[model samples]
Target: DQQVKQNSPSLSVQEGRISILNCDYTNSMFDYFLWYKKYPAEGPTFLISISSIKDKNEDGRFTVFLNKSAKHLSLHIVPSQPGDSAVYFCARETSGSRLTFGEGTQLTVNP
Candidate 1:
């Protein structure tokens, strides 16, 4: 069974608006959460990450919030720019080494 899932296949946000990407997981053993952004023909780049001990982590315009009780997580991008358009993947880390990723969500930031 798929342990992680991204319900929305795509998201569209206007430039300078807030973009919210959602993810859900069924595995309780996950210890960390991460978000990755991928561009055409390039590898996914690490965006933000959160530990299970914390509910939120933020870096500049990127923030990741974890809700262990709800088995959910979200990545928020404030003031999203056109350059931010990319496919975003939500992943859970287990055993500190293995990662389970959700189906990516393509985010389009319109200028």
Candidate 2:
């Protein structure tokens, strides 16, 4: 069974608008959540993260929110720009040095 899921396959937004990506997980033991942005052929880069202790964490234009009780999380990007277009993946770090990742949501920012 897949522990992590990104319900939306893709998202489109105009430049300067906001983009919201949703993710859900089934594993209750997950204490750390992370969002990664990947380009066409490059590796995924870490974007933002949130620990189970906090409800939200923000970094520049990226914000990650986690709901431990519901096993859900979301990434928000405000004033999205063209360069921000990428495939965003939600990941969970397990205690066994393994990271579980969602399918990923492709974001398109129109200029």
Candidate 3:
């Protein structure tokens, strides 16, 4: 019962380009959407979050877009840098604060 899925296992982008990570979910009851970035040997760090009521949220070079009807969401990193390379996970939070995460997508930003 994998409610969330990341269709692409990895993504590679040249530095200074845009990096787009996509995710899809089967559960419509989700209340919040979040993206986390994890580096090797490090715990996942909260990158950005979006409420179900909003379609898009932006913070600095990162932006998250949610499409309720499509059950899809995407995280966009503009002017991607080498340091942005990491395993990115997309998660959905249910009513009780339980979160379901998709298989992470490893993003590599090459200089």
Listed in order, each prediction's TM-score against the native is 0.95, 0.95, 0.95
Residues 73-100 of candidate 3: C-alpha lDDT, one tens digit per residue: 9999999999999999998887578778
Off by over 4 Å in 2: none
- Any runs in candidate 1 off by more than 4 Å, and if so which? none
TM-score rank, highest first? 3, 1, 2
Name the lDDT of candidate 2.
Answer: 0.91
RMSD of each: 1.2, 1.2, 1.1
Error of 2 at 72 (Å): 1.1
Q: How high is the CA lDDT of each candidate model? A: 0.92, 0.91, 0.93
Per-residue CA lDDT of candidate 2, range 1-111, in tens? 538999999999999999999999995776788899999999999998888899999999999988778888999999899999999999988878578899999999999
Residues 1-111, candidate 1: write the lDDT tens digits: 438899999999999999999999996776788899999999999999999899999999998999999999999999899999999999887775788889999999999
lDDT of 2 at 23: 95
